[model samples]
Target: MENEEETLLKSQDSVEKRLGRTTLLDSGEDFEMLEEVDDGVDDDLPPLEDAGGGRKESHQANKTVKEITDPSQCPPQEEWLDVLGNGQLRKKVVEAGSSPDSKPQRGQNVTINLKTTLTDGTTVEEESNVSFTLGDGDVIQALDLTVQLMEMGEKALIEAKAKYAYGALGSSSTPVVPPNADLILEVHLLSAVDAPDLELLPPSERISLASRKREQGNVHYQRGDYAFAVNSYGIALQITEASSKVDISPQEEEELLDVKLKCLNNMAAAQLKLDHYEAALRSCVSVLAYQPDNIKALFRQGKVLALQGEYADAIRSLKRALKLDPSNKTIHAELSKLVKKHSEQKGAEQAMYKKMLGNPPDINTVQKPQAKSSWSISWKWLFGATAVAIGGVALSVVIAARN
Candidate 1:
């Protein structure tokens, strides 16, 4: 209501000025006496647009476009910040984030909604709302630097030089920014996950955090994100050890150890899915290192080792696992498989050995001579005649000498 009145007064003043009526026409000579008229129109009601054939265009014109004429209007600039080390880059915080306590770390993974615009106000891309790990060079350096300074649920506007973004080459074919162009990024951090710092936290806190992380890992595992699940479990294990290593009540100790074992087992499961046998083996070993008779660890170790073709070690681990949990059908089945595989491998090796270094050839079977034919008799006669001729020549020579 107030805005309409204000607009009306402004319009009236402008019309009066155009007519050269500095003061209201004191006398009624210039204009006839006009009486106040009420048009039954609500003062707050919007003016009707042109009721013409181009109704849509008329309606569109009714909307008052708010143009940002000032850089300060972009966002509330509480303070200006020089960022990205060399101090060429900067950010103006429009609205402070809600979760000031949840700021992202250097190596944490973050999901953000990004809006890139050129100085001339051309939209470069729609790749905002994308997920990526920070500090991995998966995104522009300016973005990484910008996000590191932002808290969860925070939004910021980044002003960056080309070097921090696309540099001289100017990024991809339809580059968001041309060569040597500065960019403005309106970014919102959707979510972030930071690796836990287990070593410093209190023991009770460690156990609690460990449990939470383990559950998070389980959720990731159920979602089939094995790599992330493994990461979560790794964090859980770190907390577990940190809790147990410090001074703790016996009950707390047991709780921490239990969480550790479970996390290790879950880690191994995820690693198995990811085909990270060595990592899976390490997880199992970690569990076994604490509790030597942990059935799950032994079984997982056996499974990993079996897949690696270490039948002997796999059998040993599985047998131990089975002995600890004799009623476990899975363990028994796995051990049987390893044993069977071991026997088959041994038999195959023996067969190979026998084939490669088998018995020497038998005398009778040793490649016998070819059978003789009519040609052999002819060859023998020729040889005998030559020998007889030579013998006769020798005998005649001996007689001549004697004579």
Candidate 2:
């Protein structure tokens, strides 16, 4: 028992030596540093009496204080940025003035500004207000898709290549867009209009409405509303197809066919407005299929094909149209222009080939040198022989005179 007591005292002394003199002996078993409590006091004010409880409260308070002071520890904001699957990032910049309290809904008329930069360092900035009807071909597919995902008054930056934006043909330029050209658009949602109800109309009334819509599209085309005209024409085409199931009079059928052809023609014109040469070509081809000898269709197709750089096909189509309508000044002018251009191009190619082959001697340069060489060679030999004979004669005369 005395040895055990001595061992315990020695162990306590060693612990105290390591921990310092401020070590506390709890129930004569557990040892702790008194400095721990003292350190807590130094952090804030004087330490309280309830040592264990005070440490717990202090730790909790420190946690709460950190959460309040540091924003990273706070809860996230309600509205967040969403990235689209097509690698587009969207964010809401402002709420709509029309519907300030409510979030933006679909089928809104939005205003967007687009700026496109060409490789030549030229930039085109365009601002347009587009009305979007969900699943309707009112706006561009990308813009429509983007606006559907956006809330009212939301602003988004969209990145679309030419394929998605304008397909191969770019807006208002020739030679349709090059492959994979990226376009950036900044969109702002202004107001949303609710969708119109089509179910309310009777069957006959629906047919009439569709016909009216097609006529309206024609009117829009006449009035130079090409974008809206294209949209209206698309709706007309859809309505006419739907109405084809029911029996119609011969006149009505012919009217529908004519309207369909007119819509295709208008669509071609609209595509021309947008500088979509390939799309315009397709539209023109559709029109010409129904009316094979359509002069307008043939002429426009040739023009569009030419714009697309299909020069040989363009020439063929344009020449065929000119044969049918010999008096078309436009066709004649275009033919003349193409001929001159092709000739100049051929000449330039020949010149380039010649340049690659290096400069050859001119006929003047060759003839002048040959003539001088021939004359010099003949006179040089004769002059040398005559001089030698003259010297021999002089020697003979001297010898005779001396004798």
Candidate 3:
């Protein structure tokens, strides 16, 4: 008795034969199925909440902010002092700080409580205990520039023109600000600490600090601010490298190395997004130097090399990655595309060379002298005969006439 599988197969074969075609089968190609790659494009950077765990700055805007429409309720213009001398930014000290002589400088990491509002007293953003490195552009220009003028524990009110705030295109995120909207901010300088010399810190502390910076970078990256992301990652990298000379336990050293590699990889990702191909490639090479088999580094290195027109090296790196993870559809898809592109490039180069050299005409197509037709040859002979006869008759007539 024929089983169901056998019957189906037989029927299919018969139909294929009748149609004069063989049934399709897998060609065993390495990259047969193309799929979308998660090449860290949409990847969520490691969350800051668990990274060192001291404080995570709030990104949520104040949804229930109240609006005060009365003009009388606003601060008087007489008390506002121009901080920048350009009149774009003005400050009014609400309360004096504890340390009058010590103010936070540009490079210090500072913590603060801030409340921002529109000109009509509509609060747009409010957060407490938010910390950021000064002059890092982590906050709005108004906050960054205004906070510099305040001493430790000082409370101040700032009025920033649109140029110093969100500019013509106002805030697009939550608590959206309209275009060309001037802003008012109430700022409390909680504390200011100078960025420590990483080399002086113990290895454990250095690693923790580096991790925190890396988390900060992640935050910047998630917000689509690639340049700032690169900066934060670069700072984290500096912190990581600073601890390498310090004597530490083997475990601590290993952990530090891991963190350093992660920072490099993340930085490379950011650099790639920014189209800084050379810088991104160098970062990938740095990671590969420490850990040759690092998959993420290898993958990114391949992409960077391809962008720089180094197809051979790119293919090599991607092949290595694919070897490590043979089943990764994303890697397979990427490698296939690169291989196809390289082939097309070679083909185009060959075509261009052929065009420059100019193809020789085929011997068969070259025109040969045509043999004269019988009719034309006969006509030429007849004309020559007639000319000769006429000349002879004329000569004879002249001789007879002279005689």
Candidate 4:
């Protein structure tokens, strides 16, 4: 029995050594360790920690891995800077030529001449003079940074990301800059111009003048005084033109075109109102040439044609207008009345011709006798057969009675 116990103990110790773990032997009242291994084997292993602690503990490792994967997370290699003082530096460069100077001073007005294409495929050549106080929030962040670094009359090329320009929302009129888009710009510092003072002309007076002119034009147009309305519109156009030139900018070109289009359209309306059908037609045609799909021009053209006694042409024009504006009850009523009058006139002419010619038959008419229908023929045959049978039956009955 002692020999068997010794053999079992030795076998257990061999198993524990092979597994690299400490094992205990049962000795009736006490336990004994069978294997002894060094503590250095698993001492360097990671410590078991909770989720939060684990993240905090492994932050350095995670950062290392991220740096290896993405190099953009590293610090910028070159300092990104902007030379223009405005947020629109990128757009300015693309539209205008590069600036000649190297620095711009505080309170300096920069004038830039630019040529830009409109959304409607119209090209506008214009000049812009921008003046703002340095270090003010009036300029974009990137532009402000550049201005701080520059001296008076200095110019430089600036690259701006969209975040520094218009950001994600973009400008209302033109969306040149997109979100996160990188842009390049060249800027110049021109002679500074003094800001206009409202004290010279009272704000109230300015407002009153604008309101009075607009009201005068409206009243004249309503009262069928087209010449007066045209004159007023001309004055308004002049004012807008002057204002646009005073603040010479690339965007002003678009505004100028709009003003001109409005003036031309209003002038045409006035001419039509004054019973000058030919002149009105010419004006409308001119506008149509510029804007082929102008609804007002199309309507005015149709009205002028109708006034000129060109009923067919008027109808065609009005029909086209109606197609463009189907829900227009006024156009529908007008067309209906014209079509009815034309039909009535034709009917009256035909009646007069028939009376003059003694109701002569038309050359295309046929004069054939009307034939009876098959149903009527069948009914007649049946009636005749019934009458014959009745007479024969009466004769046979009389002969039988006599026999």
Error of 4 at 169 (Å): 49
lDDT of 4 by residue, 140-191 (tens): 3445444434333444345555555434443332323333444333445444
Taking all chains together, each candidate's TM-score versus the true structure is 0.46, 0.40, 0.65, 0.33
Best by lDDT: 3
Candidate 1 global lDDT:
0.66
Error of 3 at 164 (Å): 7.7
Once model 2 is optimally superposed onto the true structure by TM-score, how far is the C-alpha of residue 323 displaced, in angstroms? Answer: 2.3
Best by TM-score: 3
**Ranked by lDDT, top first:** 3, 1, 2, 4
C-alpha lDDT of residue 150 in model 1: 73
- How well does candidate 4 match the true structure in TM-score terms? 0.33
Cα lDDT of model 4 overall? 0.48
Q: State which candidate, 2 or 4, has the greater TM-score.
A: 2
For each candidate, C-alpha RMSD in Å?
24.0, 27.9, 25.9, 31.7
Q: Candidate 3: where are CA atoms >4 Å away? A: 1-44, 47-69, 76-91, 96-101, 116-131, 137-142, 159-184, 244-247, 361-403
Which of the two candidates, 1 or 2, achieves a greater lDDT against the reference? 1
Quick one: ranking by TM-score, best first? Answer: 3, 1, 2, 4
Which 10-residue window in model 2 sums to the lowest lDDT?
A: 33-42
